[model samples]
Target: MSAALIVLILLAVLAIVVVSMTVKIVPQARSGIVERFGKYRTTLSAGLNIVVPFIDKVRYVIDLREQVVSFPPQPVITEDNLVVSIDTVIYFQVTDPVAATYEIANYIQAIEQLTMTTLRNITGGMTLEHALTSRDQINSGLRGELDSATGKWGIRVNRVELKGIDPPPSIIDAMEQQMRAERNKRAAILTAEGERQSAILTAEGDKQSAILTAEGQRQAQILTAQADRQAQILRSQGEAQAIQTVFQAIHDGNPDQKLLSYQYLQMLPKIAEGDNATTWIIPAELTKALGTLGGTIGSIPVDGGGSKTRVDYDASIEDDVAADTAATNEAVQEALDAAKAAENPATTAADLPSQEEPPPPPPAGGTPQA
Candidate 1:
């Protein structure tokens, strides 16, 4: 408690205060603004800064590092008169500490207000749908405006981003409805197209099947007709062969007029066999043959002891045999021609036998004169 000791302690405190005020220790990425008598003098950089103890004072220490600020949601009216809420974020840095300290009372508050005003201006020109989709355009415009306006305040806006844009509930529901309707319309169109294609393909298949069936039927009918023709030809050939064989046997027997007359009589019943043969006429040659036969019978002896006598016929047996042979040949020729005609109708006229004059009609009363 001596006066000298109190004076020394006061001097030590004064020296410490002067040294502390003269040298400023600014953190990394920080700047200090120096003022001379309440007026901006110079800006101090980080680490080991010097200033007059009382003449030059640091008014503010500004952070030079980049900073991020997220603003709260703000209501803005769009061009369509719809109110939407939007929030944004900004990246900024203080480049000039002196200007940041002296040019504006509060740079952060000024930046936030400017951001809101610029966002309203940009969003007011766009519809709700456009505003929701045009986030990049709005962010770019905000960054440009902020960078220009905050230049004097020593703040540089590096980037601006819109965090969220929320449209009205009614608008969201309407958009969902529109999208669902469009998808349903597309599905219906595809279904209709598929059905049309299937119907066309089915019709084409039916037509092809019908055509093939008709072609097969036609081919079958042609084959059946050809087989019938061949059968008829074979039957006619068999009949002709049988007739030729009978005629050949007769010729080989060397039959006389009596035997030929008997054969003719036997054939008369066959000619008159049908029910329509009620009024058949006997030929003149048949009557002559009968007379010769009667004469031969008369020449036979009544008693078994008398000698048998041969009867002479008016016409020779050889002539009758020749006539019969000629008739058999003509019949065979007709049979051959009929078979050929059945096989090929085109050659029928050429193969047919020429016509001959018919015999005279029988006398009245169905009897023949000898």
Candidate 2:
């Protein structure tokens, strides 16, 4: 019983070692390459895999999933002889684990070196400005070359990207200054254009204002002239109506020559009232006007029972003048009496000189003697 128990324990120990060596637990999305006597063989996939325990061995483990590799910056010379430091990132995936494990000694290093060499070659054809601006083209070129070169090695380059490209500090400063100058120039041009537009608008506004003012003035003048003309027309109409009314009143009343002469005499004072008058010539027909006035007054109908006696200026004036003249220096006295009567009728009548009364008593005696 003791010998059997020891044998069972030894067999269990051997089984544990054999199991540990024969089975491999491969993680998900991973591949293990197997080698027989240091020679190429098959690849192990994910999950539990079995291999010949002594002669067959898992040489290398490769991740079938995509991987990322970042390369340090490398200095490259451009066509313009400008040195620029460029860093790159490569995305690759293992398609065949056998080739990824055995085809290349170090696939990561190889890819990185290839990336650097490819970047140098591509950038060597372009100036610094072009290299900085044309990053997509450089990336595409590198990816294409790398994908083709790694195809046999069971590596697929999914993408090649330039992480950064840094120019010299002096070049960066010069570019910044150039950009600022360009911006200033554009700003100045825009400012000038704005000012020009503003000036043109102001001038247009002023011109329009002036034209409108002139038009308004013209309209105002026309209106004023029309108003003045209307006023003149109204004044003339009023004057004409006044003259017609006066003429109609005179015709309707049929005033006599005495009334007409009185009105004419009243008008004479008004004509001489102003200092601007130069001449006051009496009418040539004054004699005819006086005769007409006398006739009109003598023919006037008396109202009530008033006597219709006519004035005889010739007899009264002749007798009085002859008598006064015979008594006191005949011719001289007659001239004096005529002058007094012509000057003022009331004063002359009261101042008539008394003649001798013997003529009245001798009148009867002379008739008997005769």
Best by TM-score: 2
lDDT of each: 0.74, 0.74
- Model 1 CA deviation exceeding 4 Å by range: 1-4, 190-370
TM-score of each: 0.54, 0.70
Q: Which stretches of candidate 2 lie over 4 Å from their true place?
A: 1-3, 221-256, 278-370
Candidate 1: give its CA RMSD in angstroms: 15.7
